[model samples]
Target: MCIRVGEIENMINQMRKSLISIAEETGLNSDDTICYSKKLDELITRYQRLKMNNKQKINQKLKIVTG
Candidate 1:
């Protein structure tokens, strides 16, 4: 599914809050905390990838226009 940057940002914020709450409840090294941590990591990675893809597309368009 195609997701906008704003949506991804919102998800990231929510995930961060959830991770913090989970970590606080169950020690950082606990299973639940670890699971949330990995999920948070995945969200961050997805956000980074999305940004990079957009940047690359912009650069490609610029090159074509400037050519």
Candidate 2:
């Protein structure tokens, strides 16, 4: 039951969209939106790194299986 890289990317995109919508609904100013956007970007970066590490682990297991 492993998640694929594409799925992870999709999840990140969805999260960003949701955050943007939330910010808009809150009627926050541009500066506030920018701050939240920065936080979202940081979160996305961390998720990407985690996904990459998981992918590497899966690849290693695959290599071992095929070897």
Q: In model 2, how large is the Cα lDDT of residue 25?
A: 79
Cα misplacement distance, residue 60 of candidate 2 (Å): 0.5
Please give the lDDT score at residue 49 for candidate 1.
96
Candidate 2 minimal-lDDT segment of 10 residues = 26-35
Which residue runs of candidate 1 sit more than 4 Å off their true CA positions?
A: none
lDDT (Cα, tens digit) per residue for candidate 2, span 1-67: 5666677677778768877886887656766677777877876787788878988999999999997
Question: How does each model score on TM-score?
Answer: 0.95, 0.57
Residue 49 C-alpha lDDT in model 2: 82
RMSD of each: 0.6, 4.4
Q: Roughly what TM-score does model 1 have, to 2 decimal places?
A: 0.95
Model 1: lowest-lDDT 10 consecutive positions? 35-44
* Top-lDDT structure, candidate number: 1
lDDT score for residue 21 of model 1: 94
Q: Give the TM-score of candidate 2.
A: 0.57
RMSD value for candidate 2: 4.4
